[model samples]
Target: MPISYTDQQIREKAASLGLIQEGADLPRQLRGKVVAAMAYGDAAERHQAPEPQLAGEIVIHGSSILIDGEHFPWLVAAQPMDIGLNPDGVSTVRLTLMAASVQVIRPEPRPESEH
Candidate 1:
């Protein structure tokens, strides 16, 4: 069973991610502003690289969003929720978007003293 949260809950979560401004309308602002989209010069070539797909059990439990078996607390989600199927014929749920975001993760910043 999935959990549900109120709009206030979602608002708070989005705020922590810096996805919304101090006084922005949470509902209206989230329409297309928070998601990351890819623009490719050639649509065909883009698809050849890797396509996004949705193949996981997405549910809201309490304040967490559970995708596949991963427990992502609070409405933390990358819009354009990309996905891909596992080559294996297993029914295991997998969050492909989470995996793909690896390229964007930056190393922890060093202290000012170290710089």
Candidate 2:
């Protein structure tokens, strides 16, 4: 796996996307959401990976969403179970930003190596 983005990079990108106010403190838990958004080409520059890929884990904290430890206050997701989606079939969850016109997702696949 590649190294994760730094606080500065994440912050700059977040600000550029208007996800957070400039110089705002992004909680450590929301990084994953940011990454997912960026990976989905939410940035002003649309050159993110053309292919959607799984990179990190999504963690839900009360009403907060964190990715790889960075908190995303403006993003929310649909719990698979709440929507009657089978966990064993498709574990991916739909995440949406506060007012953005699109949705992004982080794919969760079983590790075949563990089998």
Clashes of each: 3, 11
Which residue runs of candidate 2 sit more than 4 Å off their true CA positions?
40-115
C-alpha positional error of residue 91 in candidate 1 after TM-score superposition, expressed in Å? 47
lDDT of each: 0.52, 0.67
lDDT of 1 by residue, 31-97 (tens): 3333321112234455674666664666645446676778864444445433454567534433323
The global Cα lDDT (0 to 1) of model 1 is 0.52
The segments of candidate 1 whose C-alpha lies over 4 angstroms from its true place after superposition are: 27-115
Output the TM-score of candidate 2.
Answer: 0.30
RMSD of each: 19.1, 18.5
Clashes of 1: 3
Best by lDDT: 2
TM-score of each: 0.24, 0.30
lDDT at residue 102 of model 1 (Cα atoms): 46
